[model samples]
Target: MTATATEASPTDSYHGFLESLEEADEYAAIDTALGLIDAGVPAERVLLDLIAPAQVEVGERWARNEWSVAQEHAATHISERVVAAVAARAVPRPTRGRVVVACMDGEWHALPPRLVAEVLRLRGWQVTFLGASVPAAHLVSYLHRHDAHAVALACALPMRLPHAHRMIEACRRSDVPVVVGGRGFGHDGRWAHRLGVAWAPDAPAAADLVADERALRRVRPAELSQLADDEYASLAKRRGELIDGALADLRARAPGVREYTTAQLDSTVSDLGHIVDFLAAAVYVDDGSLFIDFVRWLIGILASRGVPASAVGLTLGYYVDELRDFPRAARFLGEASASAAAGTGPRAG
Candidate 1:
């Protein structure tokens, strides 16, 4: 950690450490974290209060293209290391029952779960920190073997909501209660409730929720009985075609997009998958706003990287044309396309 003034404010320390993250200065990041602990900050507080905020900024910087993917990954990797280092020195209190912490399938963001796992340990709960993207089946098998009191599943992206539903159901089949968290569940946990699971808005809440006897009661099975139609499923089945067609269209019309480096091209593919995935999830949850809010955020990301806002319109129009029969998708895509065409998509904060 970089040296700071004797009376530096929290804001100053936050921004200063964030710069160290952007610079990929592992020593500075680690040292700063250690120094905070030495200055009487609790290890869990350092992880949640300070380190977590810096990590969030890393993602925001990447989303805005203010930082490259490599920088984002490097910084995230260091943040994870810092969590482990802090946990290594912390003392666990009297033991509570065992719990399992894992990410939903297809969710590669493991840092959030890792933080929660460590926090649970510090709170005196024995935890199995099953890294990232654990299959639903694997989770059930573990429940059968270890007899965990509860499962804490983390999902960091809205696109993973569908999979979160799957994991939630699998846990129910094995009769294990699941407490779901992460931004994917929405700030108010609207999706988590719809998916029929306990929702934790943050790590501390998750720990508190885990300690609640009522939360561990097996909830009802997930019911997306909200949507009267199957538009989301239909689009998801044709997702491959959507991506292929979009790539071909980009190759034909978008200058430089077709000639992207391997990394750039892969990122484009991932971004497209995220778009399709989120739209499907939004529809699955029967919320048109999810897709629109996402579009606004995506536009800001693309704009920061010099991509034309109208590109969002082009891509969305393709979806509208393909799903012309799906009234729900068509309506949402149409509205979003208009927003893109008029260059009015919302910007990232």
Candidate 2:
């Protein structure tokens, strides 16, 4: 029995799986779906029908900010449980194959690749999930040690694509297939073909392609680096638009300063302070002089009259403390700032 072989008594249906998301009973939905898979549902149906719909709900909820991280985590945990439960019951075929799944180094989103592994496992393939942010060297060493038949890489951030590309090349010398998937693929489906390797639009699509034996064996010629000039341009343009819109909104709200009230200003100041801290940590200073000026302006605004520098510094300290847990240089400054903000009110400059 090959990995791609069809089931004897397929249990789950497409419509039935779609309905489960509407039900929103995470555990029950996943558990029931796994029950069907355990009873011999087709691997394709399990992915396209059951898992995909549920994930769409999760993604939509996340986009609207309607769900907490804990809520999202709960859904994902349930889904993982379902996948593992079903996989446990899968009878491995005579020639069970192997796949390596990993997030590119510096990328933290793990659900995509983890789900992909579960899908492949259902098809009777073995999987090695390296989880998130694994360094390039470690991944290459693991590939050599495991001699995986295929590598599945996921990246949620476009900035990590270069690292992903590097990892793809690492697997090339071994003749192992690479499947790149996730939010980072961007607007161009052509980027997939251009990668000079197979790319799945999502987990289900990738599994379907791999399940087809003919598609698995063919290797296309390597085109120029997938990290092209235009791809970076697209990402940069989008990022700039977001920043511009945010700054414009801030300017619009600036005139109604009194409307902020005490609580509202507190909230606004708190959020802006955190954002500045986050940007400072994540963005590269060498990117350009504009970004450097922008950061400076941001700090100045938060510290300007009608806003308290202590509160700003204190909030910044909170974020810094998160990254550096012990012996923080900012602790004393943060304490002083908090004391000043409380004594004079956050409205004082």
Candidate 3:
């Protein structure tokens, strides 16, 4: 009666499970998972095909504006509960070797790594999932006490590349090979390769790599040398000044903005700081496209929230003006804001 992913016949129930997730029925979601496991469905398939795909659908719904942020959070939270229920069924004391999985510091998207941990656990591997936002220092310290066959670190945001680089190097120093994945590392995981670490495109790939001892790569240095430049550091030091300057200038440029509520002001300030943080990461990695891509994505987010792209363009201009002495920073700002800087066209209010 064993139902491994390849042999699982409960596709009908899994769709019903997704419907429950969309409805935010936490009880039903848990029931769906428990019922599948009770029906002899393989635990691996439950994670690999069911919960994992549902989480992706949640994100897609949010991206397409079909689901509100609240709805996405509700669906994701339900998925987390479902994963725990499934993992609770994992056979106690797996004979396979130990593996440590963690999300990069400041990277809070932990579901993907959790899914991988459960899959590996079902496959008889001992998995210590460090959960979301693991500091590099804590991870290195953890490895000192724990002997892991491999350490997999997940980073969901490219903005966290700086932390990822440091964590990868720390793990390398411990002689424990690191497997890096998630959207943060780009489609081919080019950033992981550039930083001198093994790349896994998804949980399945990571599991396959973990199973293949030869695929566990040992990397040296694990560093992106361009980080030695002072531009990123200089920008970081001036981050507060940049935020204040942009907010002040924005107020002057758009006098009507003063009428915005306290919440709106806070949101505006937060978005401005993200611009700085993302720009610093781009500069640290020497990748202008990171800034450009983030800005394009952010423009959509702001437009969805009823904020004009031109408002973001104004903040970009402030960065360009404040960092006038820094040609690279100014150049990135201009390139990233090209579309926003132009009138929002017929799409904008």
- Per-residue lDDT value at 52 in model 1: 86
Candidate 2 has what TM-score? 0.56
* Model 2 stretches with alpha carbons more than 4 Å out: 1-27, 38-40, 202-205, 208-349
Candidate 3, residues 1-349, lDDT tens digits: the string is 4445435444667788889988889999998888777777778877877888888888877866789889999999999998898888766679888999999998899999998888777777899999999989999999999999999899888888877888888988898878888988877776777777788887878888988877677444445576566887898899999999999998999997889899889988998899998898888777787778788778887776677788889899878878888767888988977867764322211
In order, the Cα lDDT scores of the candidates are 0.82, 0.56, 0.82
* Runs in model 1 lying further than 4 Å from the true structure: 1-12, 218-223, 226-228, 253-264, 345-349
What overall lDDT, based on C-alpha atoms, would model 1 receive against the true structure? Answer: 0.82
- lDDT assessment of candidate 3: 0.82
Residue-level lDDT of model 2, residues 221-256, one tens digit each, is 655542243433333334444344443455454565
lDDT for 301 in candidate 2 is 48
lDDT (Cα, tens digit) per residue for candidate 1, span 129-175: 99998999888998999978899999878878887887888887887
RMSD after CA superposition, every candidate: 3.4, 13.4, 3.5
Please give me the total number of clashing residue pairs in predicted model 1. Answer: 3
